[model samples]
Target: MSRRLEFSPTVRQKIIERDQGCFFCRRLYHMEHALPGDLAPKDIMHVVARSHLGLGVEQNGVLGCRYHHSLLDNGNKGLHREMDSMLQDYMRELYPGWTPDSVTYHKWL
Candidate 1:
């Protein structure tokens, strides 16, 4: 297996500022409830995973509150089997030019 990492500090901050909160939460809940986006870099997930050559950068990052983040990663183990697929679609809409190999292994830390 190869090494993978979360977003770097600077990129993480940029992501936090850009996202402002969990876009996933907003998308899922539709702002019905108050969701805290008080997340750290650890909460940032790669839209395209590093195993597939995703870089740890804002362009490939998405913030999520703990519950939603875990659900996205784990797919709620059958609760939502297509969370990752949904996220991929959303991220692609967000980044039209971001390809898995575009910045592969170039600026990870």
Candidate 2:
């Protein structure tokens, strides 16, 4: 049995809709690019990494704008690493009980 690694469109759309914009803008108070007309989220980030066996459900996903998503994907190369690390703490808050074992599983399960 294989584990699903990517978020389905349905789940992705729901996340974008629920967030109503960048999750950081709405929740984390990051309004750097959130102007008066910004409403479309550019990416849905996994709280747990897909490579690390993260699932694609809403509880495990979040909406982010392009700039924020780039920061999330940037791994320890810049001072922005602190910014991304902060996001990890936020993810923990978002999914309080999430663990590798809880979020990862075979499709059959």
Candidate 3:
């Protein structure tokens, strides 16, 4: 049996803070171009889907605007690569190389 995977609210907030804009198009609030005065909800997307055993943690999250989020969910190959590359870059920048496991998500869990 597969366990339900979930990210804590703190992790979701961290993802929003880290990925200030959409990973795909850099839109802060909406799609590539949001209408003036419009406010669209942002989505915390998984760089690797949960079905693929992706961890429900900050390292695996990216903030995406609604349109891009759907595009990712619907299997846009190009966007997948783009998001993966971005996540890898972020991981390197944030962690450099493997540190003690305790320094990673150990404390969070």
Candidate 4:
């Protein structure tokens, strides 16, 4: 069985700082499409699920608001591609030797 990782406070803080806010779902609502604001707390989500052997390291983590977290956990149809792209960019920026193929973001999806 695959194991899940618990983030240390330092790691969690780093992720929060890096992501700033939800990796997905940030947008301007037009006058005709205004919706209630959400302060949904961010969650560190696994790019490749633990069940599928994804690690619990920062490289595999994506910051997601609660709603998006559940969507990913439950395999609900959602905006995962955006999240994957963001994470890919982040990892590449922070870890110079890291390659896109080094992580498994698309296979699980």
Best by lDDT: 2
How would you encode candidate 1's per-residue C-alpha lDDT over 5-108 as one tens digit per residue? 46778988887887777766656543343344533323787777666677776777877676666655666356344666666666678789656566466554
Q: Point out the higher-scoring one by lDDT: 1 or 2.
A: 2
Question: What is the lDDT for 31 in model 2?
Answer: 49
**How do the residues 37-101 of candidate 3 rate in per-residue lDDT, one tens digit apiece?**
33357888766666665666776777776777676676444565665566566666776772223
Leading candidate by TM-score:
1
What is the clash count for each candidate, in the order shown?
0, 0, 0, 0
Q: For residues 1-109, write the lDDT of model 4, one tens digit per residue.
A: 2333445567778878887877665632111322334336778877666655655667767677666665556544554565556656767788787654454434454
lDDT of each: 0.65, 0.66, 0.61, 0.60
Please state every model's RMSD to the true fold in angstroms.
4.9, 4.3, 5.7, 5.6
Native-referenced Cα lDDT, model 4:
0.60
TM-score of each: 0.65, 0.62, 0.63, 0.60
Which residue segments of model 1 deviate by more than 4 Å?
A: 1-4, 29-42, 51-53, 79-81, 103-109
Best of the two (2, 4) by TM-score: 2
TM-score, cand. 1: 0.65
Q: Can you tell me which runs of candidate 4 are displaced by over 4 Å?
A: 1-4, 27-39, 78-109
